[model samples]
Target chain A: MTTAAVTGIGVVAPNGLGVADYWSAVLRGQPAIGPIPDSTYPVRFAGQVVGFEPDRHLPGRLVPQTDRMTQFAIAAADWAVQDAKLDLSGFDPLDVGVVTAGTSGGFSFGQRELANLCHRGPEHVSAYMSFAWFYAVNSGQISIRHDLRGPTGVLVADQAGGLDALAQARRKVRQGTRLVLTGGLDCPLCPYSLTAQLAGGRLSDRDDPATAYLPFDVRAGGHVPGEGGAILVLEDRAQAGARGAAVYGEIAGYGATTDPHPDSGRPPNLRRAIELALADAGLHPADVAVVFADAAAVPELDQAEARALAEVFGPHGVPVTAPKTAIGRIYAGGGPLDVVAALLALRERVIPPTVNVARRTVDRAVDLVEAPRPLTGSAALVLARGVGGFNSALVVSTRDIVDR
Target chain B: MDAFTLAELIRIMRECAGEDDQVDLDGDVAEVDFAELGYDSLALLETAGRLAREWGVSLPEEELTQVRTPAGYVALVNRELAQSGAGG
Candidate 1:
């Protein structure tokens, strides 16, 4: 099987806009969730992307029509393309593909247009309405913007779609796509979006900003929603090497499954996803030294996930952390963000603390690093489970492989 | 009911639908698209769901789909609640 390598990565998260800034904030583990400056959202607190002005990254003509989520996708894609060190100026656009996942697309834009229609009329609505809120908006826009004509697609499988998008990108790369822009962007802070999330019954209604989004804590209630995007450049290892590009990590294996009705009370299908990913990577649970958990911040969700880990690796213990806890749940963007963190953690050989996991209520057989700790294993697994059934697990191995 | 009052309802609608003219209880909703009023499919579903929770009524997906305008949405919801005793 052809191995998929992650050559470049770009992130626009609440902590920081890029990888370096985001990583620094993650290590500090401070709560970035706070009052929404947007004024239109019902929920006061959110993990907003600071200092992000879409016009700076996206061209002026393109900015007026796209939604905030699409803007994030484009900006992150630009960063990933630059990081990949591949000049698309000469490559065939057909050899490039775009795949992405997002929970709410163009919600803010749709909200704006709706307000206008309510006040003025349909004539006031912009022509961009058709494209803005579509779930595939990001993928279509990114593909067109980057001139990537290769097999573009989008995933609607809840939050698990992000990882699935990367897996699809890996397949495209193996099938001869020179480069694949893969990731997700979602901004659901608008009152309309927040009201929608209310139905999910997973949002933290605590209202008290600081304690609202505590994952794996004894008082865990629910996760606070946030918005952002992350994109990675997936290319054939040989092709990347031939161009002397910097290789970050390889996309070794990806596994996914669904639980159908997990909300009321259903066991997490994590074992199947984790085991399948390990099998796909030709590795065992023991080979993985660190784990990046989904950490949804719900008491039951955290418990189930902890148990799943214990079932797979047992009490022997591996360093497990949920860095996304600090940034809040970015919905479809969460898994890919965790993937980015895992890749960096493996490279540095140190797992970042599972921010807010300082007081672990559940007796986790795995070493729950309240603080960042050294990652001993060369391989690591990134685990994520979405509301209403989607579970995904991805394996990342260090670039340097020896006689193992 | 306080939940469906023109002012309060409009306030909630403003968040999802975007900045629109003031809405009234007797306004024509079919003339408006939920997206144009700042609500997408998910947002509208969520709003309907929230109304269900607050009003103690379950607004079916079909009922919500009929909400094309602001006043129409209120009328449909109010009618459904009255018939189903959502205001208990």
Candidate 2:
């Protein structure tokens, strides 16, 4: 079977725009979490992408039809394709597929239409309403805009679904598709989505921006919501190498599990996901040099994650980091972004530190890297567990191609 | 409201249908079918909706369904505008 290799990464993140800017910000440990500029939201703080001009990156005519989430997906996809040097004009349209993970559809667009219906009557709603709010809009719009006719889909398992989307891409590549553009992007910064998030009560009500999303810290209140996402170009390893594409890393393995009943006091079934991923990669626990944690920052959830980490890798076993703490919880975007960070980490040989974490709160066996730690390993593990006990783990490593 | 010139209709078509194809507004385009113009029903729906909202000329859905060509769309819009007592 063919292996899936990551040839390119494009990120529209709260801390930065492109991969270079984002990686640099990660290395510098920059904070993008801040108070929501719009006072209409009850949740004060969030990680909103700053200074993103849609007209600059997207076609202006389609801008009104798409939600911010779709726009982010397009922008990041464009960058990823360009970075991979994949010529869309030269490739067979049927060979390129798109899969995206979306937590919510267009919040801002839906809010406007609903407002029109409530205040100005139903007739005033824009005709685009039929297309925007559906969860598949991200993938559909990307495929339509880019003319990619291969197997296109969207996964909606909230945050952890990001890795699941990439896994689907890997499956498609292994099944014979040549290229897949896949990731997660969700913009829930608008008023309606904020109200939805506030009702869920997972968002931090903290007024201070710096301390809003202090995952694994002693006084961790909760996670802050965030916007934007990351898109990756996954191609068949031989196809990528034949095209002279630069490989970032290989999607060696992926494992998904559910906690069954997370609120029933049973420990989250995260260790199983980790073990399964490592097993799939044909590597043991000792081979994983670093780990990207979920870092939900909800007190009980954080402790549970810590204990799970301890159960699998043992005391201070692997250098664990939670860089998503800086960007807040971007729902579906969170995990894939962490995967992008992990790929970059593997490439740079430097493990990025968790932002806003002053000191380790829960006592665990995992070695939490508070500073940027340099490492010498080819493999890294990225973990994510979401609402309703969705657990996802991905194993990414240098391409292990052997020729005799 | 003045009748929608070919230019205005092209702009509306381009705006509503997205940017993949350009709307030429030339005589050849004016005589062509919407399918030949790279437009679909969604674009027509949005264009007609925008006209109703902006020009107060709510073209009937039946009339919109009959609009196969650019000339057909323009004639229907002109007739609707005449009924709304606006466009000549």
Candidate 3:
């Protein structure tokens, strides 16, 4: 089987804009969740990507056409391409593709246009609103900007969409596409979207940022909404080797399962997704070095995830971490960002700590890495769950594992 | 009853779609094609929408699409303003 190697990574997380800044902040367990600036919504706190000047990253024309989400995607994609040192001129445009996950299409843009409709008239809306607010706009905009004419798509499974997008990109690369830009970036921290999120009854209503989103903690309530995510370059392992691109890791395997109806009496099948991902990677339960948890933060959800992990890996069998506790749940962006963290963890040979989580309050069945710890294994598993019962698990391994 | 001048059109164009560095909008660009000026159909639509809001003259979509140059767009807006009895 052709393995897809991650050659480059770009991140625009709330705590940090670029890969270096994000990684440093994650390692330090710095929390970026705070009061949503200038927001009138009842949901007061969220992880906003402050200091992002779209004019600095994108051409002026693109700034108006895109929502903040797409702007983050374009900027991150540009960085990923640059990091890979892959010249578009060197490959046929049709050979390169883009796949991304998006949750809310441009909420800020839609809110403005809807305000126009309510106040002035329909004529007051910007023409860009037609495509700007569509869920697939991120993938479309990235493909148009980079002229990636090959397979292009966007998955909309909420948080799990990011890993699914990456899994799709891996399939595309294995199917002989020269290269694929995959992952997700989402910015839903606007009044309209915040109202929608609040209606879901899943967001943490706590005013204090420090205790707002405590995943896996005994005091777990709910997650804080957040903006921004990551984009990565995935190329065929042989092609990446030929180009001498730095390999971060190999996208070894992916598995996704949907939960049964809540009233159906069947338990959530997250364990099946994890087991399937490990099996697809030809890995044993003991092979995974670390588990990047979904960390929904809601007590029941957290307990369910903990139960799944404990069932699969045995009681405190493997190291588990939820670095997202620092940045909040960024919807679709959460999964890809977790994947980036996993790859970085594998590279650095250390597990980043899950902040704001008390060890004594954590589930005794799962060994939550509340502090940075040395990693002695070669593989990592990333898990994500969407609101509507979407469960996805992906296994990424050191490139040496693929080589051997 | 204010006339839509070339200066006003240039301002609206820049406000709707950012200026292209390669195209000199500050020079004699009245008769230049909007395509050459780097303002595509969507940019022109946004500019038209702004004009309707600021000038209170609704330019028809068909008439707006027929405009190929900034001068033509200015004339179209002025004609709409006159027909609506809002222009001198």
Candidate 4:
């Protein structure tokens, strides 16, 4: 089976704009969640990427009209491309592809444009409003900006879309594409955007900053919204090895399922998703040393996830944690962010802290990492579930990690 | 204006348009078309919505669209409020 190795990673999150800053903030357990100060829209809290001006990273000519989401993906993709040290002088454009996942594309732009259209008339709207909010704008922009001509696609599996994108990118590699840039980007923090999220009923509305979000705890109330994006430079491991490229971790497994409605009981879909990802990697449950559980922070949601883990890992005692709790959830970007955390954890032999969580676990039998702890491991599995029944898991192995 | 109390309702008009748009009451500011000052359609809508939120009144869509300038908007809002008998 063909393997996909993440050679480069780039990120833009509320906690930090770049991957290094993001990682450091997560390690230090920085809490970036707070009340939304913008008076235009009403939402209690959001994870906003402050001080991010899309123009600086974007070509001047294209700056005025691109959606914020596309700007994020392009910026992150550019970083990943640079980090991979790809000599684009002779890189085959047709052999490269772009795949991205987004929760809501160009939402802020859409809200603003709609506000304008409602007030000023049809002629007052910008020409770019039409394409900016479309979900596939990230993939389209990245492919256009980078000159990637192979396969291009977008997934809307909510948060799991990140891992689903990796799976699709891997499948593309097996089908013949040599290089693929894949990841997820989302910033659903705008007032109009946040109000839509408020309609979901699962959103955490804790006015108190301290007790606002608590995932996978006995007092788990609900999850908070955060904005950010993560993109990985994925290439054929064999091709990378031939060129002596820096390899981070191999995409060994991916599982995905849907639970549609929480009232239906924890459906069997997520367990099947986990099993498929394991089967794809030709590995059993025992092969995983650490489990990056999706700490959604909603009491019922977290409980359902716990039930899924119990069914899959039963008595194995694999360590589980949700590092995202430190920086709030980044919607579609959550799964890939967890993937990056998993890769780093496997590399450093240490699991990142799940901040703001009480040391007590809902299920004490499971080895949950509340605080940062060191673990000797060769492989790790990251699990994530999205609202409206999207679930995905990925297994990344450190069989090829090397210092660059 | 005291810091403790809310700023005047007309203050929103200046704040939304940037520093150069602030004007004295009864000045030509009310008559100036928003587009003439580069206040695009979206900006006008956002401004009106902000005004509605601040004044605690629902500005009907018809009245909102009829007011294309800052003064027109403020007058329309005052008229709608007076008709509802909420304020003078």
Candidate 5:
């Protein structure tokens, strides 16, 4: 099958705006999560992306038409296209497509319009509200704005939907499309969003900042919520080669699996997902140098993830890291961000460390990397499991098709 | 009552439409329709709300459908302002 080369990346994480800043912040091991300040919501803290101005990246007309999340997507897509250095002078706009994963629509925009309705009347609501809160607005707006009108789609999977979206984009490229912008975006830090996240009982409610989300250790509570976007430019490997675009890495293989609800007592089949992705990449478990974990920090979820890693790697003790510990989980954006991190790791030949997760209170068989480690191989595994039992894994490496 | 100036009205219309570049601010309303400028019911309603808030007069939703041109829209708003002033 034809593979997709990730030529460029655009990130809007809580800790950083550009992909370069984000990766460096991840390596620095600083926590960006803090108290949400004023509001009376039981939820106290979240990872908020600061210093992002919609006017800075979006046109004046587009600034009002889009919500914060959509703005992030637009900026990210632009950054990726520029990074790829695409000479679209003779290219057909319809030849390209967009696929994005989102867990919820624009919460901040919806909340504002809803407030208008309550205070004034139905007529008081802004006309743009309809599109702003629609879950697929990112994909639609990105396609319309950039004129990438090929096969477009939006995935709303549990958190894993982001990875699933990339896998789908890869499929589109393999089928003959020349370019695909595949990524994930979400911002669930607002009041309504936080309330919903709290309802799921997966967010850290602790008042203490340092101990709120301790994944892989005994003190693991739950994940702190965040908002971010990661958009990638995925091109046909051959086309990318012909264009002489710099390759960060190619998505060699990806696999997805589902499990019954946690109440059903059916844990996720993550081990199977790992095996399938490696096999799809024509690689063995020994070939994978690092693993990016979901790291929900909830005891059961962390234990399950640790067991999956141990089962797959056996005695190899493959190093695992959950760099999201610094920025919290941005739902749909979390998985794609991990894929970017893995790609950068392959490029730098080093494994980034998991931060603020040195909780020694629990013992596990999995080898969690608390510090950065040098790696010998380029092949890496990135995993994401969502609240509703969606599990996804993808294999990425510096190796091109010729090497395979 | 002051007549609706084309510049201010056009600006308001573009604001209500949540668009500026697509709106042909210089287009002859007699020749061009709002539909051609990408105006829709939501924008119309929003425009109506803003107009009512600013001028203390409102247009019936049905009147919006009947008037497809910007000049028609201006005439309707002016007529409503007169009616509201007389009734008061």
Candidate 6:
């Protein structure tokens, strides 16, 4: 079976800007959630990517042409390509593709342009605004930068979009694409986007960062909105081996499903998605070493996720962790970041903690790791749930598992 | 009031989009194509937007599209300035 192997990973999270930095911080259980600087919004706390200077990472010309989200994406993609040690000249440009996910596309840039339009009329608006605020602009800009001409696309399943984007990249790899740059990054901390998020009523309004986003805990209120995410390089396993690329893990299986209508009196299908993903990978639930949880940090939503995991892995059957508790929920970026964390856990033989949840306040049948725990399993399960009923699950396992 | 000079236009162009290392803005670049100087239509539009806000000279989109060089952009902006009684 042809599988998509993760050859490189790039992260621009609030906790860390690169894979090494992020992995260290996650292992240390350092929390990055803090006050949203220079803001007066009710939900003032979030995971902002402080100290990210685009001028240092990107060319000056691209600064004005992109939004913060796209800037992060570009930087992450460039780093991923570098990490993969990929030479674009060797492969036909048509065989390389880009697939990414975005939720609140370029809100800061759009807000600035809208302010200009309101104060100075239509002529004051920037010509770049036409593409800068687009959700698919990340993929377009990355493709244009790398000259990737094959099977590029953008997924918009909110948080689940990150995993869905990787799934799309896997499909592209299976379809004969030599390489794909995939994952997601998001920056929705601006007033315009925050207002939209506030309307959703899922963001925690607490001023305290430590207790603001405790998933599955009795004190669980809601999640804090955050900025930044990760990008990954996915190459065909054989192609990666031929190129002597260092493999992180294989994107072994994927399954996605939408929940039934709220009025249908039916249960959420998160369990089915997990089961399907395991089946796709030809593994039983017991084969999964650990689970990277969605960890919505909302009581009912957390309950639903817990219920799903219990149904599949049984009560306290499998270890689960929500490392995102350290960085808050980053919408589309959160899932890919989780995938990166899972891959690192499998590679390093340690599971990073779900920081700040000292006690399991809720009666969820899953064991939440609060500290760095030694990993003994070869495969990991990553699950993501988007707003409006999008559920996605992906299985990533070591190369030996793939060989088997 | 001051006339928008090619030097000023070049400075603004550089500010809007970084100058290409291959092209020296300090040289005789008044008649050089903006594209050759690494400035695109969007950069020029941004430069024009800045001029409108700072100098109260709004270059129409049609006229702006006709500008292809620093000298042309300076001339168009000065013309708009003269019409608006903001020219030197």
Judged by TM-score, which candidate is best? 3
Query: By how many angstroms RMSD does model 3 differ from the true structure?
Result: 2.2
Pairs with steric clashes in candidate 6 = A316-A365
lDDT of 4 by residue, A148-215 (tens): 89899999877788888988888898888889999998888777777887787667777755566777
Query: Cα lDDT for residue A357, model 3?
Result: 78
lDDT of 2: 0.85
| Collision count for each candidate, in order | 15, 1, 0, 4, 0, 1
Superposition TM-score, candidate 4 onto the true structure: 0.79
For candidate 4, the docking band is incorrect
After aligning candidate 1 to the native by TM-score, how far in Å is the CA of A270 from where it should be?
1.2
Models sorted by DockQ, best on top: 3, 2, 6, 5, 4, 1
Cα lDDT of all candidates, in order?
0.78, 0.85, 0.88, 0.75, 0.82, 0.89
lDDT, candidate 4, residue A321?
81
> Model 5, stretches more than 4 Å misplaced?
A87-89, A401-404, B10-45, B56-76, B79-88
lDDT of 3 by residue, A146-210 (tens): 88899999999999999999999999999999899999999888878988988999988777888
Tens-place lDDT per residue, model 5, A255-316, is 88887666876777888888889998999998998999888788877777888888889743
Candidate 5 chain A weakest lDDT stretch, 10 residues = A357-366
Badly placed stretches (over 4 Å) of model 2 are A399-404, B7-39, B65-71, B83-88
- Better-scoring candidate (DockQ), 3 or 6: 3
Restricting to chain A, the TM-score for each candidate equals: 0.95, 0.97, 0.97, 0.95, 0.96, 0.98
Task: Give me the runs in candidate 4 sitting further than 4 Å from their true place.
Answer: A39-43, A260-268, A359-361, B1-88
- TM-scores for every predicted model: 0.79, 0.93, 0.94, 0.79, 0.90, 0.94
lDDT of 1 by residue, A1-404 (tens): 66688888889999989888887887777667877766454456778888999657775446666888888999999899988877887789898899898676788889988997899766456656768888899999888777789889998766788888888888898888888899888888888888888788888877677777777788788888888969999888888778887777888888998875635565668888998999998898889988888787888778778788888988636678887777778887888898888888877777888765556666556577778787787788988777668899999887463221
TM-score of chain B of 4: 0.65
